[model samples]
Target: MSSAAKRKLYLLKLSPEGNASLLGILQHPDGTVLKQLQPPPRGPREQEFYNKVYDSDCCDRILLELREYLPKYFGVWSPPTAPNDTYLKLEDVTRKFNKPCIMDVKIGQKSYDPYASAEKIQQQVSKYPLMEEIGFLVLGMRVYHVSSDSYETQNQHYGRSLTKETVKDGISKFFHSGYCLRKDVVAASIQKVEKILEWFEGQTQLNFYASSLLFVYEGSCQATTMRLSDVTLAEKRRVPKGLLSGGDVLEYNNNIHVINSTENGKIEASVGKGLSKFYALHKKSCSKRHHSQLSLKVENSEQDNVWKSSTCITQEHLNGNVLPQLEKVFYHMPAEPKESAKVEVRMIDFAHVFPSNTKDEGYIYGLKNLITVLQNILDN
Candidate 1:
């Protein structure tokens, strides 16, 4: 059956938070959503990028490899009544979550594409002067507060108010369940971003400008908890003196774990209800052992703050790896427990992609900063 005949006949109320389109995005019952094709250059540019990446016959290695990091794309859909209205059908990444917390972050130091005019560059720089240093910007986010049984939406204006110091805190708020914080999700998300970073490090075919990363995770506080009478940190590394008790270091098993930031007093009370743990390992020097592996150790890239392979390791990178394996094995990853707090991060908005000869240093710089911010959040 045609996708239009499936379930996207009506307007969608739950489109993403920071949509800049004249019409909202649409969702079909077939586990896909529709984004209306904008006019002229922008629409054609996005479609071109998607088609090249999605094309099966096109043997371009980078585009083919990038397919996994993006939403699965179907062909364009045009309503019979409104023939001019075209929409791109894409995988609905949040469909599986009961209450998904979503955030959109735009990456890179430059928002304008290579084809952009001087005036456009001036406008973008004036809007956010720190983009060159930060390399990323938070556009919008929606978080589900389990305590209130409601979701609060924050728009781009709130994102614009953030400073470099407060950006981590703002990002931290997305994981706050009101009752506890979800660092497990943070760790998993970092791994995924690292994978994307690894891809950017080796590729020279295209440069992604103004591209954004979309993050979605289950926000319902009814976190899968089967009263674990006992829990322990992996490898039994002793945490600092007072960090675990009340300093927000949670050291439970790796499945969907959260922490009480203010007090551990309720821990005894909450244990019966089931409480999981979260631990972020930070090593000040390279002499540390028994550390987790992070893929930020690309040999070819010029990234600093390197974090893997006889160097800066944390707890575990989960399914992350530093070496580039065979294509088939690289994409096939071990699965986490179904009950574990799940997170989905995919690259979106490819309208500004440009063919280049070398690695995207701007994007890589932004990603490194992003991972550092998340690391700080995890450690603190």
Candidate 2:
């Protein structure tokens, strides 16, 4: 099997307080840098110094806003630091809130049993007042080995041996099945566990669906493994077909149908392209009345300009060019209508590269414009 066929998985769990800490880091001026800093000393003096430096009024405001914005399913906990690196008990936070707050944990292994581990975790966390229950979310990635037999079978099925189309189809099917399984089973399980955690957090009075929107990553190694297992089971259940006399005629007929369909698709694509070009060429020659009618038709046929603009900005990054730069400026402008109140700006490619100072500046400007536009939209 190729190295690409191997799989790996990782799982993460976060309590409400842990999440708040993370959000605090994200919102801070030097958030990215601060994450690399070690926890403060465990002594009272150290704690006081750390608080003086990092815990400003702005931090309190952000924390309050976060409490309101964040989902309530997770629990929160806190403990003061000591100089010796020993921390205080979470009981303090629990006492202040007049409720239980569970600790957040993350654990994973390549061949780990998630269910058994989750059960163990639930047992361990039960010692806390508000943490009698716990939940686990799992994420994984896996690579499947396309055996020589399956490759030959796929090639025969398409009447061409392992072509680009066959490989594309196989990979697409693999990813689709993996994604679906994660959403249906793993995500549902996470929600179930979170509900158990919430119940322990003194949210017993509130009613919630078992499958509420608990966060779950769609792509992971574990999801891939589960998907592969399912696929293997399905393959095992398949009955092999027996060759019969006079099969040549049937095979020929199927080949002809396939060839015809391929030809038809090519013809359709060519025709569509030709028509698009023709329309574009003649569109400018129309009379004012015709142009007005065309404009109305176009307007009705396509999404509104605002939506188009928003989508376009999201698809591309700002490069200090006129269009994106203008968008960045305009995003800071306040607008009317609550829906348009928030500006959506896209500048940095978060996935591909680390954001530079210039990109950060662009993002800030874009956010400013977005807020301004939203304000205008709301006022009008």
Best by lDDT: 1
TM for every model, in the order presented, reads 0.66, 0.16
lDDT of 2 by residue, 189-237 (tens): 2333333333224322211111111122222111010121224322322
| Model 1 segments more than 4 A misplaced | 1-23, 223-339
Alpha-carbon shift of residue 228 in model 1 (angstroms): 9.1
lDDT tens readout by residue for model 1, 157-253: 5566789979999888777654345676788888899999999998988898998998888665331111112333212334322212223222121
Model 2 accuracy (lDDT, Cα) = 0.20
lDDT at residue 320 of model 2 (Cα atoms): 22
> Candidate 2: where is the Cα deviation over 4 Å?
1-62, 68-83, 87-380
Go through the candidates in order and give each one's C-alpha lDDT.
Answer: 0.61, 0.20
Q: Could you tell me the lDDT of residue 253 within candidate 1?
A: 18
